[model samples]
Target: MLDLIASLLADKELDCRLDHPITEARAAFNRAIAEKKTGPIKRLLVEDAVLVTGTDSGVISGRDAQVEVWRADFAQAGRFVYVRTPRCVLPSEEEPIVTELGTWVGKPEKADGSEVRGDYTAKWREVEGKWKLEAEIFTTVKSRDALAL
Candidate 1:
């Protein structure tokens, strides 16, 4: 009984420690997007990070390429808002890899006043004590009728 209690306490402590870094990473990402600061976004990504977006069909590989895409998007965008919430955060036991399944909503500064909602899975790696995004795959949420052939 004592062993079980101690194990449970240790697990809880581990969870607490994991939450801080994950939450901070997410907050930093949101801030970067909101402020339109590509530098902060690049700092959060690994050199060979992969980004697959719902807007485009092509996969963006490498941090420099990803930043270039964001630069173009940011240039065309005005008064935009992007928000994401993590639904699940899974930390790997064998490697320093963490995967987060989340929902993202974006409202572009457009005349149509449309909002884009999607689900994303982001893989992060702890590089030199800092969590950096390694890869991300996004899937847009569409209506049933839209999927109908």
Candidate 2:
């Protein structure tokens, strides 16, 4: 019972220390993507941040490059509101780094029902009292074609 108590306290402390900050940062990122704005995304990522998309050859390295990729994608004819909702954030009691496990989806901005959903894992590090995303890897598990069935 004492171990359970300690575990609960540790979880609470972790939540207080990192969970809220990471949640806000992630929400801002999602909103930026939905709004097709890269500034917020840029602010939330580290200088050497990396991203692996849900497609082949999607290894995007560097914060500037990732922002450029988003810029190009935003300029495309048809774009979706990309959102990543975190399901769990691993605790880092002594370290400044945390792991976030979540699901991602590209929902059609219209009523097209062209949604592509996937799972993703992101690494975030607290840099100067701010949680900045260091790396994120996404895997596509469901596609638009699959959604129509």
Clashing pairs in 2: none
Q: Among all windows of ten consecutive residues in candidate 1, which has the lowest summed lDDT?
A: 140-149
Score candidate 1 by TM-score against the native.
0.77
Q: Candidate 1: lDDT over CA atoms?
A: 0.75
Candidate 2 lDDT, tens digit per residue, 11-127? 676452335578889999999988889999899999999998877737889999999988998888777788888876775778998878778888777747678888887899999
Model 2: lowest-lDDT 10 consecutive positions: 1-10
Which stretches in model 1 have alpha-carbon errors above 4 Å?
A: 1-20, 77-80, 110-112, 143-149
Highest TM-score against the true fold, candidate: 2
Root-mean-square deviation of Cα positions for candidate 1 versus the true structure, in angstroms: 7.8
Q: After superposition, how far is residue 13 of candidate 2 from its true place, in Å?
A: 15
> lDDT of each prediction vs. the true structure?
0.75, 0.82
Best by lDDT: 2
